[model samples]
Target chain A: MSDLDLLKYTCGRTDLSLICDLIDPGSSVLDLGCGDGLFLRYLKERKNVRSLGLEISAEKIASCIANGVPVIQGDLDSRMEFAADGDFDYVILSRTLQEVRHPENLLDEIVRVGKQAIVSFINFGYFEYRFELFFCGRMPRGRHLPYEWFNTPNIHLGTLTDFHTLCRERHIRIVSAEPLGRIHGILPKWCWPNLFAHSCVFVLEKEK
Target chain B: MLLIEPQNYDFGPGEENALELDCRKKLYEVTLRYETCGKLNADRSNAVLIEHALSGDAHVTGYHTPEDRKPGWWAEMVGPGKAIDTDRYFVICSNILGGCSGSTGPRSIDPATGKPYNMNFPVITIADMVRAQKRLIDHLGISKLLAVVGGSMGGMQVLQWMIDYPDSVAAAVPIATTAQNSAQNIAFNWVGREAIISDPKFDGGNYDPENPPGKGLSTARMLAHITYLSDETMGRKFGRNLQENDHYAFDFRRDFAVESYLQHQGRRFVERFDANSYCYITRAIDYFDLADRTNGDLAAAFHSAKGKFLVVSFSSDWLFPTKQARALVKALLANHLETNFCEIQSGYGHDAFLLEIDTLGAMVGAFLANTLNEVSSGKQRGAQS
Candidate 1:
C-alpha cells in the first residue's frame, strides 16, 4: 500500500498528522531521517509540496526514489553541508531528535537550512514513567520507550520543559507547542504538560 | 524480440563543422554510430539517450538478427516493459567519438592521410563526445531529450550532457560514475596505456591492422576486467578452483580457473577492440574532472543545469566507489537540484550497474515515469502562462 493509505490506517497512533497539519500547503519540505520517505510522500500527495529527504539507509533512499520523492543518502548526524540557508520552508525532524548524536547542533542546522523547524519526540517526564522510575529504580519502559537502556536508540531523551529550555538557551522562538497525552488525547489545559503529556510536537524558528 | 540495425551519421568536411578537441586540434569527417529503438512520439519529448561505457558500443538492446547469440549490452534494462522500456520511450545509444565501434576514432581512416589516424587522432574529452552527440540529436530533430542515461564512462557523458546543454535534457541518470577521475583511476589507466605502448608489435601505434598488439591489448583488458568485478564475486565464481587439474601447475601456466577466465576475457577483447582506441578513450576518461572549469567548485559546475538527477552506485564497486557518487550527489544537492541517490546493495562491483537488473530496473522505471509526469505537467503550466 502507498504511505498515504498506510497513514490513514494508523493516523491516531502517532503525531504524523499533527506535523502534516502544521506544514502549509505547497511549501517546500526537507525531512531528516525520513524512513522509507513515508512522511515526505505524505506531504507530496496531500499538500502538493515539493519535498526532499535526507536518509542514511540505501534501502530507504531507493524506496524514496521509487515513490517519486527526491532524497539524498546522508547521515543526519553529519554536517548537512548540502543544504543551503533557508532552502526549505519546513525542516521536519520527527521522532529523530533524541536519536541523533548531538541534538543541539542538529537543531541549529535545521533552523539554518529551513525557515521553520518541526520537532517531535516522546516526552520523557510523563507521570507514568516518573512513577515507574521512582518506585522500581529501573530504566523506565513505556509504549514509546520500549527498549532497555542498553539497547535503546533514544540516547538523549528529554521532557517537554527541557525542549522549551533548550530553545530559550539557543535563542530560538517556539511558535507552537502541542502536548498529546495517550490516555486523554490532547492534554488538558489544567494539567502540567511536562508531567502529563505522553509526547510533544514543537514548531520553532531562530530568533532574529 | 526486436531486430535492430546500427545507423551511421556523419558530420563535417568543412572547417566550420569540424569538432575542436580538448587537446587543441580539429577533427574532421567524424562519424557517430548509433541505434534507436521504439518510435519517437509526435511531440518528440519521449526520447532517451543511452551513453556506452569504455568497452561498450552503439548496440544497447535488441538482436541484430534472428540467429544472433546475444542481445545488446544493456538488453536487460532497455527492452519491452524493461526499466528504460523501449515500448514507451524512444531510446538511443551511440558509440562514443573515441570508440572503435564504427565511430570516427583512432582506428578510422584519417581524411588527410587516408590511413588509420592511430596516434594522430586529436585527444577527445567527455564534452567532445557529447558535442558530437548533439549533432546527431539535432539531425534527428529532437530539440530536448527526455533523459540521458549511462554507467561508468557513459555516466561522464551524461553529466556533460546535463552541464553543456542544460535546457536540452529533462533528466539524467549517472550510475557507477564520478565527476572527477580519482588519482588511483588515473594510475590504472596509465598502466593500461603503458601495456599497449610497450608491446613490441604496437610500434608507436602504427602496427599493421592484421598484426596489432594483441597480447598487450589483451593484458590491458584482463587488468580492466578484474577492476569490474568484486572479490566476493570472484571468490564465488572461481574460488581457487583449478581450471583443468585437481593439483596446482607450479609452472607459469594457467592453473587457476580465474587465470583462464581472465585469459578468455582478454582474448575475446583483442578480437573486436583497437589498441589505439583504448589509449585515446582512457586518456579522455582521465581528463574528466568536471570541477576544473569552475575553480574547483563542483556545485558551480552544475550552476546552469536544470534537470532532475538520479545518481546510483553499487556498494561493492571500489573502482567507482559509493563515496565518489556521494560527493557528486552532495554537489548536486548543494545546487538545490532535484537529486536522488542510492548505493545499491550488490556483490558484483562496478559491473553491478549492468548485473543488478531487478532493483535498478524498478527504481529507474519509476523515476522515469515520475519525470515524464512532472515535465508534462510543467509544460501544461507553461502553456497556460
Candidate 2:
C-alpha cells in the first residue's frame, strides 16, 4: 500500500519514516523539537542515520534516555551555537513549525546546520479550517489541530502558501513539497493546493 | 555483599614518579589508591573512569567489609544493574593524589624525614589530581576510556580529563561542576579554611599526635556542609526547630536542630577525614579554572576534545548552578563538540548528584551505551570502507 494509504488506516501519527525516507543511508541528521526521540531512533534503525536530537524539557529528556536516544536538552529559538554550519546531511523540523518562537530565524538556523532540511507543519489555510472560520465563525479545530486557541502550542500558525512566500523572500528554495491528509492526492490541479491540504511537508535547501 | 580491599599503586621512595604541580612544584613519590569493578574487556575499550569529589575515597561501590554495613558512596547507582552498570563496563575509581584515603597526601610519611608530610607536602591543584588519575589509568594498561563520569570536584576532574587527554576518552559526564569556581565558591572555601586554621591546636598544619586539630577540622567540615545544601533544603530538614525542646536555649549550647546537625556532621567528618588534607583539597579546588591555561579562552580548552559530552546540573544546586553548566556547554559548542546538557528539576542543591540516583543513573547509562554502539558501528563502517 502507498504511504498515504497506510497512514489513512493507522490510528496515530506514527509515520515520520516518510521524512526518514528522504535521508540518505549512513548520513548524519539532527531533529529539532525532538519529543521523546522516537523519530530519531526510527531514523537510526531504518536509514543508518547517525542522528542526535535537541529537546527542551527534562521529562522529555528523561524519556529520551529511557529509549536510549542521544538527545540534547536545548531550545530551537536559542542559538544552536553548538552545531556548525553544514554539520548534518539533513535537519528535520517535523510538524514543529507553528510551535517555534521565530519561524524565519529557525529556518535560517536549519539551513545553517544542515546541507538540506525537511519541514512539516499544520496548514492553517486548509479548506476545513477556512470553512470553520467562514461558516461557523470560530477558529478551526480538527484531528491534527487538536488544541484550543488559548492553549495551542501553534503560536505562529500560518498557511503553506505563506511559508512559500517567506522562503522566496529569504532566498531559500523549496526543493520539494507535498500535501497531506484524507483527500490530498485525490485533489486535482487548479483546486487550490494550500486551501485543501490539511498539513504540508517540504524539502528545503539554501540558494547560495 | 563485601568488597575487596582497594589495591594500591605505589610510586615508591622519594619522588620516583614525581608529579608536577600547577603551582610550579613537583610532588615526590606519590601513590594513588584505586579500585576496579568489572573485568577489562579483550579490546580494553570498555574502561570507564569514575573520579570522586572532595572527601570521596577510591571506593565508589560495594562494601569494604561485611561488618562495615555501609556501601561505598555511589553504591546505589553503580552496581551490577545500576546506571553505571559494572557488568558491562570496567569501572575504575581512584583516590586523587592529594587525597588522604590510602593515597599519598599530607598524612603520608615523608620519605626523607620519616614523618608525616603534614604542612611540608607540596601544594596540589585540581589539574594535578587529574594528572595523578591519568597516571593510574596508565598503570592499569588501558590506552583509552569509554567515558569519565564524576560529580563536583570529581566533575572538575572529568572536564580536565576531556581537555587534558582530548583523544583518550570517548565521552564524558560532568555533573554538578563548573569550568571555573565562582567568587562565591572561593568565599565559601575561604570560610571553611579559616575555621580550620584558626584553631589553636592546628599549629600551622603540624599538630600534637594525640590531640590533632579535631575541633578545627570538624568546624571546617561544618562550614563546608552548609555550602553543599540550599537554604530551602536546610529549612526543610531542620528549619528553626530547637533541639529536643520547643523553647529556645539562651546558653551557648547547640540549641537549634540545624546547629546540632552541623556539629554532628563536623564531628563525624574529623573521624574519617584529615584536617591538613581538607586544607589542601579546598585550596586545589579554588585554584581550578580550565580557561586559565588558554588565557581565558574557554573554547580553546575543548578545541582538541574527541569525546562526546553530557553536562548535567541540578535546579537547586546554587553551588554549581545551571548557568555555569550552560556556560560550559557554550564553550563545548563553540569548539563544535557533541555536547548534551540537562538542568534536572531538583531541590537538593549540590548534593543532588549523589542523592538523585534514578535520574543520574539512567542518563549516564544511556549516554554511555549509545556512545559505545555508535563508536563500534563507526569502526565497522571504517573497516568496510
Candidate 3:
C-alpha cells in the first residue's frame, strides 16, 4: 500500500494523536500487531523513537522492513522470544487486544517487557453495538467494528469496565484512559463513553 | 583528492607515546595513533580510517603482535586488491579509545590519580568514541576523509562519524548495524556484563592486575560469539559433527569442534583484550541511540551529510540483520540523500561483510572508483574555471 493509505489505516485520527503524546523521542518501543508498521515508522521518523514491531503477517513484516522499521513475524499467542525483560519503555497493543486468544497472558508479557503498556480496542458495550445486539438481534458492524461476525478475528469482545476490571485484577494500574468517538471532538471528557463511544484507549503501568 | 599506490610507503613503526590533540569539548585530550600503508601528503584526501569491530585492534591487515604467527583479523579484506583496496587508499586503523591496544584503555594508568581507570572510567557513548577519532584525524592534519568504514561496532562508529561531523567525510559505509540497539541486544549485553561482574575474580570490575578476570571475560566472549554466527552457517560448518570421533565424549572436554573453536577464540581473546575495555565498549554500544542524538529524527541526522553512502548488509547477519540496514537506507532516502544498498546473500552471518571476499571487494571497489572519478572530474572542471 502507499504510505498515505497505510498511515490512514494504521493511525486513523485518534490513535496517532494518542501515540504521539504517549511515546517519547528516543524511547525503545515495541508495537504488537503493528499493522503495516505505519505508526512505528511515523514515530521513528518524527520522534526518533527506536521501534520494533511484532506482527503475524509476513506481508506486513515485509512492508515494515522495506520501510526500515524492524519487525519480527510471530504469533502473539506464543511467548515473545525476541525481547527480554524490561527491554522497551512502552509496548503498544493498538486495535489488537480483542483479537488474541489469551489477552491476559499477552498483557502479562507486555508488562514484563515494557515499563508501560498502551491498549486500544473497540468497546463492545458501546450504545450502537448494544442496541444492534438487543433490538436488531445481529452483531454490530460499523466504522469501528468493521468486520462481519462470521469472519471477524476479534474473539474476546470486551467493554471499558471489563478492561478496567481485568487491569485491576492483574494489579496493572491505569495511568490514563480516554473514550473515543465522533462526539469526542466536541466534548472529550463529558462524553460518558463506556456505553456511548466506539472505542476505548488506556495506558497502564505495572506497579513496582 | 590525492590517489596513491597502497604499498608505496610506511607509517613510522617506532613506538611513539600517545599524542594528545585539542578537540573541542565533545572530546578530551585522548591519544591519537595510526599506522599507514601508503604515502602521506598534504591533501590527505586519500586517507581512509578503518574503524574496527568490538574486541578488534589497530592491526588492520597485518600480522598479530607478540605471537606474529597469525595474520590480522581483516587480512582478507584490507590488503592490496581487497575489498578496502589498500593500494589506492592510505588506510589508517587504530584501536578505539576504550580499547586494549597501545591506545589508552581501562588498563592504562590515570596520570592524575596514578591508578588504572578500570570501571571508574567515565561511561562513554558511541559519539565520544567518534570524537576521539575526530581528534586523531585532526592530529594527522587531514581536512576530510575519503570514507569511514567498518562492521558491527566499527559500523556504529561509521554512522556516528557521519552524524557527528557531516562535513568531514566524502562517503560512509556502515555494515551489519542497526539505527539503535534492540531490546534483545540490550539483554545480551546485560548478560555479558552480569557474567563479568559475577565472576569471583571480577572484584566489582576491579580485578588484580597480575590476574585479571579471564574466566568471566572469556564466558562473555563465548556468549557473544554465538550471536555473531547464523544458524544455517553453523549447521553447515559444524552440525552434529563430533570433535574427532563419531561418538560423544560425554564430559565437557571440548567434545564438539565448535566448542574447541569457541574455546580457542575465547582463550586467544583474553590474552590481548582487557575486561574493563569490554565493559566500557559494550556500554557505549548500548547507549548508541541515533535518534537520541539527532533530536529523535532519523532523517534529520542526514540533513547536513553531503556524502554518498553505500550501505551493504548480509542476508544471514542475524546479530545486526539486513532489516536494520534497510532502516538506515529508508532514513537516508527520506532525507533525499545519495545512497546505494545491497543485501548480499551469504550465510557467513554478521562476519559476511568481512568474509564474502569477491562480492564485497567488487562492490566496494566499484563504488569507490565511481565516487572518486566524479570527485576528480569535478576538481578538473574547477581548475579550468
Best by DockQ: 1
Model 1 segments beyond 4 Å from truth? A1-10, A24-27, A45-48, A84-86, A101-105, A128-156, A161-175, A183-185, A188-190, A205-208, B379-385
lDDT for each residue of candidate 2 in B1-385, tens digit (9 for 90 to 100)? 7375798987634555677788787777778888989878887878899989998998999977888878889988787888888888889999988788999999988877989999998888888888888888888888778889999999999999988887678889999999998899899888888888998999998886567788888988887888789988998998889988789777899899999999999988988888889989998999999999899988887787776888999989989998889889879876657667788878888999999888877788888887776565665212111
Ranking by lDDT: 1, 2, 3
TM-score between model 3 and native: 0.60
Ranking by TM-score: 1, 2, 3
Model 3, global lDDT: 0.73
The better-scoring model by TM-score among 1 and 3 is 1
Q: What local lDDT does model 3 show for residue B288?
A: 83
TM-score of predicted chain A against the true chain A, for each candidate? 0.94, 0.90, 0.91
Residue B181 miss distance in model 3 (angstroms): 1.6
Report the lDDT tens digits of candidate 1 across residue range A1-208: 5766867744765578888889899999999998788778777777988888988887777688877789887777877777778989999998889898999999899899999999887899999899989999988998888899999999998988888888899888898888888876667656898998988888989899
Q: Count the backbone clashes (under 3 Å) in each candidate.
A: 0, 2, 3
Q: Report the alpha-carbon TM-score of model 1 versus the true structure.
A: 0.91
**Candidate 2 regions with alpha-carbon error over 4 angstroms:** A1-28, A42-50, A63-69, A77-90, A100-118, A133-138, A148-151, A161-177, A184-190, A202-208, B12-16, B372-385
Model 2 chain B TM at: 0.96
Measured against the true two-chain complex, the DockQ scores of the candidates, in the order shown, are 0.63, 0.46, 0.02
CAPRI-style quality class for the chain A–B interface of candidate 1: medium
Tens-digit lDDT track for model 3 on B212-320? 8888889889889989888988889888787887898778788888887788888877887788888988988988878875798876777766676767788888888
